[model samples]
Target: MIFVETQYDQTPAALNDLVENAALAALKHQSAPENATVTIVLTDDEQMHSLNLDYLGVDAPTDVLSFPSEEIDPETGDPYLGDILISVPRAANQAESTGHDVESEAQLLTVHGILHLMGHDHAEPEEKERMWQAQAEILTKLGLGNIQVRES
Candidate 1:
């Protein structure tokens, strides 16, 4: 199951569909278990900054943050991949500069976060290439082939 929560007051309802489709596409591309679950939370820069500072020791807000989990949910016995938190405001800002809609930016962030939960990291040159390729493939499959996540 894919779950999405929007904490921002101005977040559009359509954002949920974009997030859900992106999450599902990434999971399908990875051949994740049918019982696997992924949760997405959309918020503002303030919440993202707080989470980044508290968990990652960073003082700035990022586009997305993933908390991976390999264990099954005790009550449901379903494999819970993890939680993906996105800053809607951040996504909007990125979309503005990237010449894409916020929905597409949200989808890109969703794919990026799901890749992280699936153990893909871009800390090195080769790893970045591999991860970016995977992102391209997944986005293409989702019909957003032209969308690219800007390097930071």
Candidate 2:
């Protein structure tokens, strides 16, 4: 299951169908066990800037942040993947810069965050290759409303 909480003025603050589709795509792409859950939060740059500084030691606003909770929920036994927080304004700018729609950019971030939750990292060359391959595959499966994965 995917739950999204947004605190921004972006109309249609959240897109339920795309979120569900991409999340399910992530789970299926990873062969994740059943009963997995993830939460996505959409806020502004200030919130993300503070979070980035506090956790990553980077005093800058990033497009997205993924916090993976690799433990099972006590009561439900659900594999809680993590939280994906996005800066809506940042995403909008990124989308415009990248020649894509805001929704597409946000979904890409969702795919990236879901990949992180599934233990895919891009800190090293080999890891990056695998992560990009996985992202491409997931996004391809997602077909993301015609937005393709950008080379990273």
Candidate 3:
């Protein structure tokens, strides 16, 4: 099981659990190395905006950002994926915009974040297709059909 830490005070209890479940499910579906570890830090949009500007050269806050630490470990066979940081307030706004519950939207973003940790990206057409399909399957299996994953 993966451990998730949140810096936001308003983050709901169920939100963390949903994120964990999504991470576990994504790891299993991706066939990642056993016991692969990563950390997730949830914060408000203001913090996320600063992080985005500092790390990604963007001025706006994003839903999630993934920083891959050890894609391939030489010492250990287990591949340490990466760290995922999500904005709780942004997620809440997205949930409202996408017509889904807060928990479901957060879980979707969590799944998307875990996919990035596994080296899945959506910058190109083929890559986006594969990543989105994987996310859709994982979300569907996790009972997230009502929540849509738009190709943005």
**Better model by TM-score: candidate 1 vs candidate 2:** 1
lDDT of 1 by residue, 18-72 (tens): 8999999999998889899999999999999999999999999998999999988
Clashes found in each candidate (C-alpha, N, C closer than 3 A): 0, 0, 0
Residue range 10-70, candidate 2, lDDT tens digits: 6354454666677778888899887888888878999999999999999899988999898
Q: Report lDDT per candidate.
A: 0.92, 0.81, 0.86
Model 3 is weakest, by summed lDDT over 10 consecutive residues, at: 71-80
The TM-score values for the models, in the order shown, are 0.96, 0.90, 0.92
| Candidate No. with top TM-score | 1
Q: Give the candidate order by descending lDDT.
A: 1, 3, 2
Clashing pairs in 2: none
lDDT of 1 at 131: 88
Query: What lDDT would candidate 1 get against the real structure?
Result: 0.92
lDDT of 3 by residue, 32-141 (tens): 87779878888888888898999989999888988887765577666667888889988888889888888998888889999888888999999999999999999998
**Candidate 2 all-Cα RMSD:** 2.0
Write down the TM-score for model 1.
Answer: 0.96
**Poorly placed runs, candidate 3 (over 4 Å):** 71-78
RMSD of each: 1.0, 2.0, 2.0
